[model samples]
Target: MEPEYWDKNPFKATAKAFPPGFHYRPTTLNKTRKFYEFILVDTNSVSIKHFKDPKDPNLNTHSTIQILKVMQPRHYGSNLNQPKKFSAPFDPTRYTYWDYIDAWTNVFWHQNNKYKHSWLIYFKNNTTYNFPNWFLQWWNYFGPIPQIYPEEVQQGFNQFSRMFNNQESRIPADLMYFSSFALSWIFSWQYRYGKIENKFDNSKAALDQVKNWFQVHPEFLKPADPETSLFLNKKSQLAIFLAGSKSKEILAKNLKEVLHLLQQQEEEEKPSKKKVESSDENDDQDDDPFYQNEDDCFGISLEED
Candidate 1:
């Protein structure tokens, strides 16, 4: 049977559309999201082709991996009144927030280069509502940052350090602590909900990093005065808890054993009143000197027989 078509044009073929003997893999930084780079490999010939979009004309089809260098920034207007904008300017500072996003979109969809395709798409699509204001302000304040793997983590730590060091930043210590805790929670959630690989390790590592930071910077753990020591102590306790061992299986087993012991104790504490009542109803009743009223009925008489 012939393949289906619409408007006499073939349907957009994703990585799954490729036939046997051709291995198709779409690479993305975020595993939960769509793939940015689509790579098609011919097992028979061992050749490979990489493309952001399969429909693009300038797809990089080669025998080996292609290394697309970062694009160089174009010169701005000499007078600053008019600015020169390239399709994908290498420097993000040259353009406004929205303009930079537009340029990045162009790079992802139009140009063929080594810029992180997945991240660009993520930032562009995710920040559409905020557009250039909040994003631009943050960018300008923090400057340019690389969105790649280890560098991303390093950049985040550097930013955190900058905020921590700035006395004028006015960011609360508890806020910072909670922010790190929230990140750890997010990583844990991802691992539990989506079962994303390495997420558990990442979450553990993040908690450890936060714990180390607090340990090293004892000042942050201290209160401004002795009056606030209680609050500070509570915060410290929470920090320790977050960084502590998270063995759920062991915890569950311990909880089960405790519950079982409690149940057994409850059963033991429940006296066999029926057996005592049946054995010596008259003798026990008559001996009970304190059992004068109905409220004092203990079934065992306290009077001398």
Candidate 2:
């Protein structure tokens, strides 16, 4: 039996019949003939290849693993411009965010280059960005971040934001904290409705840290009185509570309700039902005017955008 068409030329065999969520752009580097760059449009992942053999023009026969690079969308002519941050160059190996974190832990803590530590070192050398002191402290204290569940990352980010008043340089400790809490909530829910996985060392340590913080600052755990509680909808509540001269205690007081709500939902949800989490991080690219009038099909460009 013949293989599927998508398997034959997954990228642009025909002008209009390529796979969804993927894009192809023709390129030229040196005298390389008929070179093309395949891109995962959604993830901004890119892979470049040169087709030397006419029999294997389509990438279906090519090696899947190559130099993979992350592409940052460039705004050619718009006010939506910001200083460039360090972006990893084309790497021969494909790495996930987890791998990056692991390598970072090994390199930063042990001063060991045993792992694939190039990414972090490259980032540090190329960028002029200043990370927060607290963020650096968190990484130093926890070495490798603990394994986090897919479901709890958002909640962890939110809780962490509340704790730090939505600072741009906030640590992912809260996010990791929620991953640690995953077991408790899963068991708690399973006992009532239905159930959940691994306990990483760093995750456990993070849980302990959060617990110690709460123990020292018990007032944050206290519920705010409804009568005098601030009336806040989504728009202004975060701004008022998480970004200002307000104290951490006051921020925690306001965020207390959200924590309760998350816990309560686990009990409320029926067995086999999955909770859909809306992403809090928004990409400013969509709102940028640069892409508003430009063609989506990006051709080859040797120079930087």
Each prediction's RMSD over C-alphas, in Å, is 21.6, 25.9
What are the per-residue Cα lDDT tens digits for candidate 2 across 141-233? 432233323334334434443554223324344433332332222211011211113432224324345556455544344334543443333
Candidate number achieving the greatest TM-score relative to the actual structure: 1
lDDT for each residue of candidate 1 in 1-305, tens digit (9 for 90 to 100): 13542233222332235332122221221211111122111111112233444566554321122212112122222443343343432332133323332332222232123322221111111111212233344333222222322333444454445435335324443334323432211111111111122342333224346557656655554335564876577556655644553698756665576567658866885676556676678778767876657675658788898
Scored by CA lDDT, what does every candidate get? 0.34, 0.33
Write down the TM-score of every candidate: 0.23, 0.20
Error of 2 at 305 (Å): 85
lDDT of 1: 0.34
Clash-forming residue pairs, model 1: 287-303, 288-301, 288-302, 289-303
TM-score of model 2 vs. true structure: 0.20
